[model samples]
Structures are given as C-alpha cells and as structure tokens.
Target: MRGKSAKYILKVDDDMWLNFDVLLRILKTGAIRFSLGGKCNYGQYPFRDPKNKYYVSYSDYPMSIYPPFCSGTAYVADSDVIKQILTISPNIPFFRLEDIYIALCLRKLRYEITNIPGFHSTKIYPLACLYKSPMVITSHGVSASELRNIYQASCDKDGSMYVPKNPQQLPERMILEQRWPKGKLARKSFKYEQQLLKHNLF
Candidate 1:
C-alpha cells in the first residue's frame, strides 16, 4: 500500500453494490479521508461456541468486548493507515474478525474510526428513489440485473420512471414496472419485481 500512488484505498466485497459517482462526490467534499464505513459490533462479545464460525478461543483473543469496528462489506482507509496496520500486525495476535482486528490496530495507533450512515451493513433494496439521493453510497444484496435497473432508473430524465419515497405520494400497490427494466433475463427480473410488489417487500 505504501508503494501505491493512490492516497486512499477503498476495500469492497464482491457482493456489495457501490456507486462510484457518489463515492467520488463524497471524497471531493473532503469529509472522509482516513477510514470510513458502517460501524457494527461496537461492543460485541466474542463467540464462545466452538460450532460458531466466529468462535474465538481465549488464546486468540482474551478480551470479552471487541473494539468498535467498521463492517468489512466495504470501507475506505487512508494509505498511511494501511501501511501502519501492516507494520504492526505481526505483533498483535491474530483474530478471526478481520474488521475487528483492523479496528484494534487503529486503536493502538490512536486513530478514530469514521462511521458513515450511507454504508449499510445489511441487505437493502436498490430502490430508484433512494439512489437519487447523493447521500446514498452503498447497498447490499444486489444482483447484476438489479444493479442495471437501479442505475437506469437513476439516469431517467423523462420523469416516467420516477418513484416516490413515501407510499402516500403514490397509489396503493401501484408499481411503476417500466422503471425497473428487465435487461438480459426479462421474465426472471420482472417476476422478482412482481413478487416484491405483491409482498410490499423492499
């Protein structure tokens, strides 16, 4: 990371949905430079059950509460912070939770973790109305087709595909199917939207 020319590093999971335009806009504002992501498991206790995937033995981590850490789904760290973490990692005992481990390293260096509300840790519906907001940064549980639909809806200029955020602003159970285009797989994507509308799921 120290050898890289980029001043900041953005680490993202393959499953997460990212809006590069919005992220760039945020960076341009200079509000977030060091480290920023959704903070989760702030004071969570280490898993004790051996069957659990996150189980941590006393030898690995004797501490009960984990330090506040950002969700590993997606996060941005300054280049210097990345280099510092690598330099000190060998001394600090390894932990299964990489995010928590990184937080511990930051704590040792006396760096603050910046939490962004835009970074959701859980799955979120890629609704067109939500994406229109410049504050919306990342969403989880996004498929290829859903990503296409959301991006298209965001770029719509005719106002035909505009959906209101409030249910009261539109008709009851009225779905603007035209806004959500069925790209490569027509039926599969359309049916998924129909099911979502039927269940009022978002």
Candidate 2:
C-alpha cells in the first residue's frame, strides 16, 4: 500500500478495533482530499498562559495543524508524498522512532492531518459515547490485555449503544513516580528546555 497512489492510509495500533463501515460512512466528506487514521498524542510539555504556566492541551499549539498528536496511525498523500518526504536532503536518519519524524515532515509540508473519531479500543469505558457528536480520534497508554477485554465486552454486550466497561486498573503511584524520577525538577529544567527548542519558545 505504501508503494501505491493510495487515496488514504489507515494506521491502526496493535490493539485498536474499528468498525470500517462506520468509518467509511463518516469519511464520505468532500473537503477531505485524503484521509489518515491512527492514534496520535501531543508530546508532553507545559505552556504559559500569560498570568501563569500550565500544561498545554495535547491537541492544541504546534500540533494543532495535525490536531490529535503522536502519530502511531494516520494516512498520508500516497506514494508521492511519501517519496518526497524520503528524498529530502540530509535524509532523516533511520531511528527506532519513526512517527515523530513523519509528523515533522508532514508539518514542514503544511499538510492538514485531521483526526478520525471512534477508531479507538472498544474495551475502554463508554464505548457508545464515541458514536456521539464531537468524536474522539485517539487513546493513549492502554495495554494489550485491556484492549482485548474491551473487544470481548463489546461483543458480549450485543453491541448495545451504551454499555459501560469496567474502570481501568491504574498503575500504582510508586510506579508512576518511578517513571518520572526527576519530577518537577526535570520538567522545570531539562524537559522545559527541550520543549522550548521544539516549539521555538526562545
């Protein structure tokens, strides 16, 4: 599919379960010249709001053009766009991480990457709510088992529109804190500096 002139690309996470029929129905809009699907997350960073500092909404700021951020899944402009991106001078080095690089490329080209809602795990809570207006395009930090449970429960409920899934078992605070050992110091200093550079804050 990457080699062909695809009209759209649907990127799916390992755990995502989608209703293609429903997706097709919603994407019939003419404004969308091409479509991309996948889970995206805005990088973690804080922003200043005049009076004080606060964490920016992931969907806002530099990533606003891409809307939902962190490109695990998405569609691009077929092989042409892909080829052009790959051909850029000082070709981007091959890295273990690829999604951010792709997002940066699309950003440089001024492409509009919109979110396709209702394309997330069916096992998460309030699955039916995804069908409502103002759709949700992505989910983050969910494990494979959690995704499986969601799919199973969605099936068991006979596709009822409003079935609620069990609350997710969140990781312990000790674990969470372990993941961010430097805490406020790291965020206020090193992380802050990196974000400033990425967003051109200076």
Q: Which candidate gets the maximum lDDT versus the true structure?
A: 1
lDDT of 1 by residue, 75-142 (tens): 88777788888999998877768888888898888777787756766555555555544444676656
Model 2, runs deviating above 4 Å? 1-5, 34-68, 73-80, 93-95, 119-123, 126-161, 164-202
TM-score of each: 0.70, 0.44
lDDT of each structure?
0.65, 0.42
lDDT tens readout by residue for model 2, 68-99:
33455433233445555666624553322355
Worst 10 residues of 1 by lDDT: 169-178
Once fitted onto the true fold, the runs of candidate 1 whose alpha carbons sit more than 4 angstroms away are 1-3, 154-202
C-alpha root-mean-square deviation, each candidate? 7.7, 14.5
Which lDDT value does model 2 have at 119? 42
